[model samples]
Target: MDRNLIVTMNAGSSSLRCAVFERGSDSPDPLLRLSLRGLPEAMIWERKDERSGESLEEELTPPKVDSDAQAVALAEMKDRLLAEVASERIAAFSHRVVHGGRDHTAPVIATEEVMTDLDALSPLAPSHQPHNLAVIRDLSSGFPGIPQVACFDTSFHRDLAQVDRVFALPRDLSEEGIVRYGFHGLSYDHVATALDDLAPELSGGRVVVAHLGHGVSMCALRNGISVATTMGMTALDGLPMGRRPGSLDPGVVLYLIEERGMAPAQVREMLYDRCGLLGLSGISSDMNVLIQSDAPEAREAVEFFVYRCQREIGSLTAALGGIDALVLTGGLGEHVPDIRARICGGLGWLGVEIDHGANDAGETRISAPEARVPVFMIPTDEESVLARDAETVLED
Candidate 1:
């Protein structure tokens, strides 16, 4: 059998998701998917065969060593993929890079110059960019001659309005690239395309997509283009994430440094690693865990999450004049029905009403029949976006 494939990798701070897709005329055909979560301390590796609908999962304990556990996991993943498909038949390796700054508004080949430019933007997205680029570098080294493509999360919001992109700071800082460059563009891009196919009527209308997961963000798509988003110059500026404290006041940051005597690096670490659901609940960062817990702290954390999501939805709705459709994607948004119901419960004034039965059954359209705005649960496919962008770059 002819086997031409593209491998797409999305590496987060603590997890790595890789998939194999066969080259197709319209869209890439998935062959296999692999993910390694709960990294460093312990890794849970899961593999699914797209063709056979079979899955296998196991815990991977790295040998105690000074070397990086993530690198070892990536190398192991590469070996497993190679065992199934030959290196020659793998057309390209695509990646989801978290930031691209101002100039890189489109997918591009990961050349030396491109890598250098992306490296400079790492400080803006310290939690994600470093790991993403590290995976790209590792893949480039492992697959010497194969082309590596970078699909930026910021690229989809490249056309964001000037008002949406500007900060209240000095004009010179904005010119220096300290402006809103929304994250989660890959997921948003997938949802936009899916909407075009599934809800053509709502595709060209105003839409708001809530991408809730380990890293959460919302985007306002005006006729399928990002006009505004919750995230700003960094991913940390958006909705609170699994371990990130999002949208904190600038004054609080100052207070931490001046009053608390915390260094900038310490503050950054706390914001990126110790805050959010984990910090709030004093439990796991996983939303599923928080929901299952009966602790008041956990409940409050969940409530805060939903509250922030509703507020952001309202904010994005205003940005789009009004929301015609609301899309829920990402892990939590797609899986948790109660969370969805809670979020939509407060949006009744904004014409958002969801059918509890439909939502409970995990139906696609969860909105009430008499609702003015439709609510959809669309599972996002960031890998497909990466694959398509890789194909585009290869063609170019």
Candidate 2:
């Protein structure tokens, strides 16, 4: 029996989330071991009230309080975590770093140089990398002696063929660290493993896992191996997300640079921050809000998102010759039944059939039993996987 406590952190552009796990005595399953979770940003947020002329309680409605910066958030979270399980009980902490480049294929205990290297990949994953590294730095400061390991989101796709990873560019450019490194592996890994646990029959077949959250991507797994993925060199490359512009036309990019006089940094902000559902709808980035909104633009944005997901689903299915199971995961995929239903609305030809009652109730299996292809709602557990990885690194 394993005797260790581990922490798994999934830090994003704005929010920092964590889960605590202790290896169970009976269950060999990673999913069952996860116990405690804390989301510092999910609870706290910032917004202004029009009537008060001053900042008021946006946190309370949703009701929360905000810490000043990443460090403060980490310190507070760590303090609370310590109260739950003493620091001495924790064997190690495993963090989810977004882009590992070609060099970092496996998880590594953190070093100053590794932190700097991860920071250098910030441009590749602007929305997630910086914050991921920040959490590492913050933890390093607060828990100086505790060992920490960095597990990357891109490591799963590291084995993609060279032809699939590069653009049609010059040799020098291709060699200069500009290439595809898919993100959200920890989540995809969760889905793949869950597929084995929940339905062993589907584990060795072709499966497309859609990770729909604030940031989104679809991974095509063949025999549980990543043959292709929607996201490329950066998180901004595929699927219109909560607030990110998926793939922009090269012509449009040139127009922004040449005519709009926008610098690369400014363009980056426009794509990474101000685009996607919020930019397209002009209402809110939240999918629930968009669904409820009667505004034409909002409805249009919702339709566009669904349509885009379908398009990619078809593309990925083709790459695998055909699809066996389509798994839905992440925040919206698991909870927002309407979105999932809409995505597979006309996908009957691909053998996807949604069970209306099960979907509405957010059950684990949302697909019709008679549906040609199985559709599953496997809520991702990246944190537990990280914890398991930490345990492996420390004790194995």
Candidate 3:
């Protein structure tokens, strides 16, 4: 238990988010958060104080041109942050891995064999797994003897029913781990636990949480356990994301390959890098930008995003048999009030009503007093969950 600092990392394809937490018995105390983004070209590093909300951002000197350089930059940044800390002992380095396949339903120590197995599952999560592992490998080599843990984003949905996990494929295929393993479990886990303190009534009731950031997904929870979720097999299977197509017909891929003579890699790049808000609007992939533009394409993209979210709410509502509450979290879910309004507009049948003023003010409870289902806006903290898991595994 002498490990002084707990480093929690969530590495994406384009960004690496890290938080340093002071070791504690229950929940670790947040010390500082560092975000390094734009790894491909010019890397931008941002440092924020967890308690005071103070922030500072600067460009990475020499700029990380590729993943290797990015790893080095991260290592250097970590060392700099450690120097600021009074202790040199790092207890553990925890990661937010996107998929755990089937075997890893919980956090596990990331040994060499574990990293190899996770690397094999990279194709299943092209955007996250590789980068996540890269950081792990980097840290492992740089700081020998430090404990590392991998917390799967899919681990939260391990309790989903068999029917919910199946893909209507042959039983043999399902047995081979080709089932609908949901993503964003880490975010959902945070929200689920946070609800007890934030809204006890809705926390114990049937709740559907929508995590709508650059990556979007929804989950249905009964008594704070995952019942069903929108994402399946891969992150690309659910609600449209910042760049992902989301829930496309399988036949579309066949058409692109057979009729249009497209390569699988080409299609993958298009789907993962150039679709959704960007493809639909022919504009930037960021929702903030799309929301501000007055162009018709921008409007169409925003409308389509809202439409898909509305449909997902209905699907998840059916899964829960009814809706007691709806919670929104993530970049767009928390910051953009108009998107939230548009999503709640068509759910009047479910007795969902938004208080315009409350919604705009970013209040916790945005639903009207008389509404049957109360909607809440809560920020998600996946890093905190990962940190606690690291503490548990290390302690155990």
The top-ranked prediction according to TM-score is: 1
| Best of the candidates, lDDT | 1
79, model 2: CA deviation in Å? Answer: 2.0
What C-alpha lDDT, on a 0 to 100 scale, does residue 167 get in candidate 3?
Answer: 94
**How do all the candidates rank in terms of lDDT, highest first?**
1, 3, 2
Candidate number that wins on TM-score, 1 or 3: 1
- Give stretches of model 2 more than 4 Å off: 1-3, 28-42, 45-68
Candidate 1's residue-wise lDDT over 146-259, tens digit each?
888989999999998899999999999999888999989999999999999999999999999999889899999988999999889988887888898889899999999999
The true-versus-predicted C-alpha distance at residue 49 of model 2, in Å, is: 35
Clashes of 3: 0
- For model 3, residues 1-396, the per-residue Cα lDDT tens digits are 366788898888777888888876454448888888866666788889877889998987655344475566667667766766533467889999998998899999999999989989999899889888888887788777888899999999998999999998889999999998999999999999988788887789899999999999999999999999999998998899899989999999999999999999999999999998999999988898999999999999999999999999999999889999999999899999999999999899988999999999999899999888899999988889989899889988
Q: Compute the lDDT for candidate 3.
A: 0.88
Candidate no. 3 TM-score: 0.95
Query: lDDT by residue for model 2 over 244-326, one digit each (tens)?
Result: 98877879989999999999989888888789999999898889999999999999999999999999999999989999999
Which residues of candidate 3, in runs, are more than 4 Å off? 25-29, 38-42, 59-69
Stretches of candidate 1 exceeding 4 Å from the true structure: 1-3, 25-28, 62-67
